[model samples]
Target: MWLDAVDGYRHLTPESLKAAMPRCPRPVAWARALDDAIEFWGVTDIAMLLAQVGHESADLTRLVESLHYSAERLMAVWPSRFETYARASQFAGYPEKLANEVYGGRLGNIEPGDGWRFRGRGPLQLTGRYNYTAFATAIDDDAPIKTPQLVAEPIYGALSACWYFVTRVTPRASIEVATREINGGLIGLADRRRRYEQASRALEA
Candidate 1:
């Protein structure tokens, strides 16, 4: 099928994708979307892309970013913003407030409520109005800006994830470089590498 057309992705059949991401609800759709994205973006490293997507979306189970965090977690995640437990407790368990506090005043989210409005979405967790606007412009579609939730849809999610991978991270970059590009750091790096190895094995099998 579509996987056959991808230069180095011939072994990534729908069945292998399912094996790599057992929790994904629509393996076929994901395969088709990935095929289209690889062609559209000239992606060369399918395994790295799959690993990043799987890690970002929790094996394709989470399409939206979950901001819910406890005080301790908030402090840990945003040490600068939530310098202390008392400061973190203010926005603890409040996703909207947490998003606004951390994401507002930057990333083209000047307007009030823009933080939560543009919270991470899609398989790659596209965040910020800047990225949303940029992706919309790249795809020549205003829908991503007007209806950002559309990024959560399977086709759009996969496409957006691929776009990020191709544009931000080189197609053939190492998994470490790709992870840094997508995550802005080495967060969950061990898990990401594990997932990458699993996807590689599944696709190669």
Candidate 2:
């Protein structure tokens, strides 16, 4: 009954949204907020939105960026950029060191802990302090920047993912373009396209 009235996108209902992401945290609330965000933002492609959400957050399970990397993993992740750091040390603080070196003093993060504090969260992997600030400003919510960690909740994750689609994808109407915008490149092009096609079939059905 309620699903029929959800902008023709039942992907948010607990049953439906949970079907989309079985491990989705707080499924009922996530469904409501995701639907509201989609409708309020005028997002046209639920499939694309779902695809990005699926790929970026791993089916709504990971709103926070996992920076817990060993030196080997760090080297693998940032091979060309931080060869020295990758070669130097491999300890418990590897993630913190990487975060500060890579993210500190950039994207409006000026303080020491700001790197880890403002690290990527949300479905679209909203990274950096500047993006956190922008998303908070866009949604008129100060919590994302002030608290930052709250954005890692699945509800805000879905909201920010929708925000990315409305601001970045609706303008182009191309998932490829949206991919570039959200991913900064075609990192997971094939997987994202697959997810889009899969989501399209599921939503359109």
Candidate 3:
């Protein structure tokens, strides 16, 4: 069941992707980009990806609501980091918030402005401008790669997320590494990974 769903997700058209999204666009370009990114990353588990997105976005419906046309919108609406940012007065303080709220504070002092940077945005919720820039370069377009809106743009968002995982995170990185990067390196990755595995097994079953 999980594997089947993964396969199904992999083949989803732009229309299907839009239907899955909160804000559907007329173009399938985003879907195509997403599919291409997944393929490029050698991510065989589509169910895993979808499951992660579902968990991160608190289900598909909420996920759609989180979508923005640009990085600015995404940055503005991003609930998790905003709380931290609101409390912190300086860049140095960002790590504390990210550690405590975002990554369970495990990756001590990793936040925007500080080193160990590049936190979260897009479908996979990539973090850090460096990673974002890298993704933009890979995609090779004029879009403002740093903005959440670009990251939220369905196809571009997926591609950017995938590019970060495949290129920056490394395939050798465990699910934990990927999860930490995606979910801020907290406890959620393990549970999400398990759920994804279950879903994947169900699909294969």
**Residue 70 lDDT (model 1):** 94
lDDT of 1 by residue, 57-164 (tens): 988889998899999998787888888888999998899988888999999998899899999999999999999999989888888889989899876787788899
Per-model CA lDDT versus the true structure: 0.84, 0.74, 0.51
- Model 1 earns a TM-score of 0.88
lDDT of 3 at 19: 39
Best by lDDT: 1
**Candidate 1: where are CA atoms >4 Å away?**
1-12
Question: On residues 63-137, what C-alpha lDDT tens digit does candidate 2 reach at each position?
Answer: 887787766666677777547663636533566666777788988889888888888888887888888888888
Candidate 3 root-mean-square deviation in Å: 10.0
Off by over 4 Å in 3: 1-33, 60-120, 146-148, 168-174, 202-205
The alpha-carbon lDDT assigned to residue 197 of candidate 2 equals 78
How good is model 3 by TM-score? 0.50
TM-score of each: 0.88, 0.84, 0.50
- If ranked by lDDT, best first, what sequence of candidates would result? 1, 2, 3
lDDT tens per residue, model 3, 20-47: 4434343365556666667766765565
Q: Give the range of the ten consecutive residues with the poorest summed lDDT in model 1.
A: 1-10
- Pick by TM-score: 2 or 3, better one: 2
